[model samples]
Target: MAPTKKKAEKKGKIQEFCRKYLTVDFVKSLIFSPDKLSFLTYFILFAELALNILIVVKVKYTEIDWIAYMQECEGFLNGTLDYSQLKGDTGPLVYPSFFLYIYSLLYFVTSRGSNVKLAQYIFIAIYLLQLWLVLRLYSKTRKIPPYVIILSVFTSYRVHSIYSLRLFNDPVAILFFYIALNLFMDRKWTVGSIMFSLAVGIKMNILLFAPAILMLYITSLGYINTIIQLSICAAVQLIIGAPFLMTYPVEYIKGSFDLGRIFEHKWTVNYRFLDREMFENRMFHLGLLVLHIILIIIVAKPCYLFFKNYARLRTLQAQFEPQIAAENREIEDLVRKKMRKATKKADEEEITPEQKKFMDSFEKGMKNQFGDKQQMPQTKEEEDPQKIEIHFDQCVQLALLPIFLINFIGVVCSRSLHYQFYIWYFHSLPYLSWFTEYHTSFKILILFSIEFCWNQYPSTNFSSILLHACHLILLFGIIRKIYKEIGLARQVIKKEN
Candidate 1:
């Protein structure tokens, strides 16, 4: 009995030690570290790749858009004005001429035995490379959360995996936009500018980002550097566009800009928000533009003011000195110790621990006025009212605002949005979410839900419409929050107070 009791006590001690040191909690802490996010990112990307490959295998290669692209390639080879002529009135060459030129060349060169698969394989390669570029950009912008990056790629309602699987120019443009944003963030202005221009080469819609780029550059590098960067961007665009302007100027301009002047009969995934024919009228286009301008103005103005105020607060923090005498005593003691060590070191010809302590103390005191904490403490002045509001109940409101504004105005009113237009919405949604100020987890959850539906839900009659209406209602809620945060509600509060 004595021996058993002793053994039990020993085991308890061992278990206690393990609890303090080598326990499941310790292992969990390590696993949940920031590095885990990176691992998860790679895992998700790989899973997506595998799923897409399976999709390609399950569907016949000839049944997809790649066949249509092959027809376009044949037209280009035959010196036809339009490559999509093979589709007659049924299919259209919605992409720019450059898009057909590059792919057509690839088709002609690679067209042989098993070349159908080869063409699809080339696209798969491009998608993989583009995914890498997007991931790289996400890494560069540590300011953005990993979940936001994932949500943008996956849940973006417009960027269905099936749409991506189809042959489209959007993927190339998406890759270029990401590369440009990454380079711009890294302060590689010339490189980013060139990439941005190349993106425009693939699709002129990339020109929409100019305002955002200008805003980003202005904030980072100031006016002079922004001008220099802008010039470089202009030069690259001109160099690419000049040849087309010189040779086939009229056709290029007309086809690129005016191709969508008249709307054809087709239903979009978003048509359920309003009547099915909302896009057929030019008034819809004008209304959308007006809304876009208003929203941009509202967002941009407040952001500029808040940033300026925050900058001033930082400058003031640098100047303010702490007044605590307890902090100063340590510095004074260290100075005395240093003096004593200096005398001893003179005799011994070596620095002592006392000397090291004195040097470290002096450095610390120099950094913090009046020997207070060397690091800045979080304070009310440094905090913005708007940011605080965003963190709590206001998060969902912030997430919904840009989605409502952008989709209703920018997307619904655009010249044309084929199935590929979903890429623009999918890629841009999360960033727009950032503007709204939702919690990272909530944004990811909401996005994941939306994406899951689009990917898997049966597209039966009325189902797509119901989902779109649901989306519109969600957007409406978001807009209401934005109004409360930035609009007339604030004025009412001011008057009441």
Candidate 2:
């Protein structure tokens, strides 16, 4: 009995330790204190740089796309515009002329296409810049929770490998994607559209975000503005592709946009169950088409609801413009009166300097919490009547939902998802996780699933399927949550009326 009691006590202590140490809250507190978080971020960046350098020095050779990229760069330097002529073991270069031009510049810098190391150093710099862009985008609107940053760093091992080991162009495209997203968030529509077009020029896979981008522009900026943005996007694409089209039209078109171009099933990281013959079968392609259609149908209703609510909000704002203006004026007047009263009291008080300082600090805290009363607009137009009182964050989550669902479907239907394709959806996971606010266990499980599948050399079919299914589930959950929030907002509006 004594021995049993001692064993039970030991087990209890072990459980307690696990409960305390293995919690999200505990980890968040430990790593996210401003000083500790900054140190950890810099440390991770340094370690990643060191690891990339060591791999570049020690591994020295890769049986992947980098060799082909270098060969193509050489062709560019030799004034060869035809990818067919420059085709190597990795097949023809399908990326746009802008991509080749960038490589051509790198080639010239690397002693006329001789030094791979210098080119890799350039890639490392781009990777670091991409990380900074991601951090900036996340930290722009609100403070990024510690776990998001941690996951962004740790769950991206595959991305790092792709940049350093494989030296793929996916990272460059992703960097542009991040820049576009950041600019779009700040409401720079035209420039953001141009950046997005440049990303698509690098890789057509970036088109996965097209639906969301279109929806956002339409709802936020109206049909005319959206049309203008689309025109800009098309113009940019044309300008980027003009050189290749004029020079080697057939080869460029086949290499850049041909989905039916040969892809071996064995080369696929996902869809591993299908063999070469099955992959090439027309029936298999049709089945994939059906799956994509079904995914789109599932997302259609929520997308409709999202836009419908936006329209309703616009109508409400327009109808209630006068009321909203009057209410704003009332609020401004109330704030100003409070501020004046506080100032008058402070001036009348004959207090010690220490007391005055304390009062001033308290007043400053109040101003910070409530915002500066002086900044309130005095004019009707200046008060921004067009601004919807709806939950903007929830709207953003809804807008991103269909985009993620489309990418999820793409992953599921992909005949050949190489390591580079992971860039299409991996970086968006942190943002999705932030918006969903799922249980910590579920979040961790999804992150692990994605990281595990992406890290696989020949990705196991089961893990790949699991990763796609998990992302779809997350997207569904987020859409459902947004739907509920919108419903609740409607109810509140009705009640107020």
Leading candidate by TM-score: 2
Model 2 earns a TM-score of: 0.71
Q: What is the TM-score of each candidate against the true structure?
A: 0.61, 0.71
**1-497: candidate 1 lDDT, tens digit per residue:** 24545797799999998887697765564344333344456676786677557656776653445666666656656756532242422365555555555666767767622365555556666666666765554343233455556546654433534333465667767677777766654447789888887777677666666555665566545799889888887776556546455666666566555534655435344443445466567677677567667766655644343333333443343344243344466667776777687667655764567887998887787877655555556666332122111112112122223322444335534544445655655654544444444566665555565455455333333644544543454454455555555656458779999
Off by over 4 Å in 1: 1-35, 62-65, 68-94, 112-114, 140-160, 222-228, 272-278, 303-409, 412-417, 428-445, 452-497
Instruction: Tell me the tens digit of each residue's lDDT in model 2 across 1-497.
Output: 24545797799999999998788977777565432344355566676688778777877545577667767878867788776786656777777766776766776788765676787788888877777665554443243465666666755778777777666888888888888977875567889999999988888778867766777787778899889999999999788878777898888878777777557776677666666788688888888778767766766666656755654554565577677667778777776777687668755764766886998898888789898873545665233233324323323334445555556566666666877888777766766665566896787677777788777777676866776677677766766776676678789999999
* Residue-level lDDT for 376 in candidate 2: 44
Q: Model-by-model lDDT, in order? A: 0.55, 0.70
After the best TM-score superposition of candidate 2, give how far the Cα of residue 101 lies from its true spot, in angstroms. Answer: 1.5
- Report the error of model 1 at residue 92, Å: 5.6
lDDT of 2: 0.70
Native-to-model Cα distance after best TM-score fit, residue 68 in candidate 1, in Å: 4.1
